[model samples]
Target: MLDRIDATSITTIQLYNQPFIRAFEMTPSLPTFVPATQLPLAIDNGRLVLQDMLGVGAYGSVYRAIDTQTHQTYAVKSLNKAGLNSRQCAFQNHEAQLHAKVSGHPNIVTLHKVVEENDCLYMVLDCGMEGDLFYTITERGGFVGNTMAIKTIFSQIASAVLHCHSRGVYHRDLKPENIIMFGRSVKLVDFGLATTEPVSSEFGCGSTFYLSPECQGGFIESVKSYDSAANDVWSLGIILINLTFGRNPWKQACPRDETFSAYAQHNDFLQTILPMSTELNEIVKGAFCLNPKKRITLSELARRVQACRFFTTPEFPSEASVVSAATAASQASFSTTMSGVYPTSNLHGPDDKEDSGVDLQSMA
Candidate 1:
């Protein structure tokens, strides 16, 4: 189902199990700019008519747009250039380049084109009419008993990540908010924080709940670099938990978080606190392993996910027991040497705590 975009140069990259064709050429040089304060009703010389606002962010908003030429619909992400600093501008360019590299994958969002003008930058992408995974999960109250659905959705997401990795792209900010859906099909989006570097010293560069302990840093005092690929794997494990339960295992992955501390010390801690099957627990354990070198690779993870049939225990944990385990774990001794991070309010949907100083550079 890999759809190749029409491009001039075609190259192949070695994937974990096989070779993958990396199509899509580097985009043409950015076009000349025309300055203006507000979004244009028509862009690309009236080819696209901007419609309703789909969502809004600090620097920009996404709008539903229609191509007058093809009569096709798209989600246009419009960023206000006046609000972005030099570094932010560079990151925006980098995001487009990295996203283009991984665009052809079936499970990843297609970046149709990049348009710049009138004090703003616009990215025309496939519209996800069903909204994001966060809203979908919240509406359904998690995929706890839906094993088949979980398998299908998670596998697609994994495939998308694998595809990105095959292209030397690491999506540092991997979370439910960045995962959109068109019916049951998943599309990974937002590559502003993504990097081509296999390893990065950019600690605290992702959402708190999804970041690995290494990425969170502050444990050993001295600076340390982390494997970005492994960081992505760790985020996937958290995402799996969110899909199985309606909630996150913890607020953050750092040792300072009581819930995460309990899981780190005891192998069966997750089961003690939640209704998770041993089979699914093993997968989470592999992904959450403290040692980045030993964390399961994306290929191995995809294989395990495909093989796993059960994701939750038949009997759910009692409310009292869940509370008791959380209470006891609150007293567990964990490294107190960690940097202060804003609490990640909820995993399922957006909350008022978004601007509460997350450890990432930009949550675009």
Candidate 2:
């Protein structure tokens, strides 16, 4: 039976599921404060004329706004004051801090400035208009291309992940939605689920299907004791499988909550996802290894992806195909060269590896 939901009742739905208009209701009324050092923005002419709203989630709404002075487009993510006032403020603040710390990386979305309007926090980032990789791939007809194309796209994603890891940032939510593509390039977005250090206790931060086994266990207060980076690698592997097969690894599995656990314990689960390609199969298996220690690192994964045989394939004639072909060839070369230098076996095991070398203090 279709429930007769009214305008007032619509706001009760989760932000991700609600329409933009209904979700906008969740945004707190703007606060009045003089433009200060950290907060330099105002509702100029009574409207925040942004290019468009890219996405809205429990955390906030992401909009493409232009800097009038510089005339530069930027992604402005505004935190929902209601959610902030609730218990989620700490997580939101933590995410903002993480973005602030890793703001300058090319692969990572650049954070322009932070603003507080009406007690709500806003993060302005350099805008990328091409939308997310997930939507792009779906629009082009699921999983369209040769092995080389897959290798190239995966390598670009791996490079971004490597950048995050080098800085001790683990993108707990590594999926197509979070991967934005502009022209031929890709950038990682949505830091709401990212963390500088592992959550030792048991709190899960990512989407259900993409989350790692460890994250599904429970809530962990301390970030220093978990293998967050390794978890990110696992999610990346799942994403790779999805891209190659045009569907999730465990799409048919019952009870979505148990999917990760099932994948972690069974080799058949790995085998099931392998027919995509011998090379990509091995890469996914290594990344999805239940033992975090045994799983592949982003650096090694990047190398493996780059060196895959698919990269040697002939280029497609179309301009899009040509760009994809170039990206694949470049990544394949890098991966092959890197594999020789780092070697897959040298990666850290789940128990042996400590925190990533980067400091979390600044990110906090």
Candidate 3:
């Protein structure tokens, strides 16, 4: 279960320019939620019985459940009925409809069904027996030297994103934690922050680590508008980095952060720290381009990910190289200037939901 952002932290704003619908924010907040034990046990009559609590998010809680009729296991995500406002209800409906739209891809978690009881809205999802990519990466200490593994995992992820885009849905949050793994295969989950619009000005909507500079809006010089597809591409690029090195590039994608400021100012700053190959470096650079318009397309990004061979050089970066890169980046003046600062952002890692421990035998 991906932890949904709190309702209080998010400001209700208009998402699009034409229709002018009020958009719900998926930003983080303090954990103020109804415990799973407090919710009703029986769902869809007495067919589904809720078991242990899997995890809790902002709007709801996910529980390991069993279908008594079929004797099959499932995870049920239940949204709290009493807490939902009109905007939150809109968000819930939008999430269900949009997620269902993009559900058939092999690498995407399947939405089995949606059941709206009088007290809760339940989403029956595929049980990820092996937890998420974040846990895998942490356990293995990253995929630094394993090009084959990285390529296989990333290709599936990119393929899933491409499929979503084709279906007119854009998953605003694309971090590793939102991806559930079943052995070698993975399924993308958590459409809580997704939008049907191709472009959005909903700045600071996603996790801080995977946000693009344009999305990390806090400066007068920052682009007021951003391409949603390009922003997703930027997050994919960060995931690529995580897959390769097992760590985030920076705390935030703004000039205020020293590491990000260096990368933004110097072209070679990433290579200086990480031993990225030329081809991989080019992909990263393209994905992280300051201008959203110039950012690489999702299809092209997938193509490049498949084409690239080595993600890193055979050797680690020399101490001297690191110093030189840092010095050069520090000397260059900050090209993007700042005016106002963003509200203090929560620095939490990607969604850390526990595995349901139920192996899904069905793919379709």
Look at candidate 3 and give me any clashing residue pairs.
none
Candidate 3: tens digits of C-alpha lDDT, residues 185-255: 77888787788888787887776667787776632275666777888999999889877765566556765
TM-score of each: 0.76, 0.66, 0.76
Better of 2 and 3 by lDDT: 3
True-structure RMSD for candidate 1: 15.9
Write down the lDDT of every candidate, Cα atoms only.
0.66, 0.53, 0.65
lDDT of 1 by residue, 111-176 (tens): 999999877888888876655565445433335455676778889999999999999999998877
Tens-digit lDDT track for model 2 on 277-303? 455667777876756778788788778
Question: Cα lDDT for residue 318, model 3?
Answer: 47
Off by over 4 Å in 2: 1-48, 82-90, 218-225, 251-274, 310-364
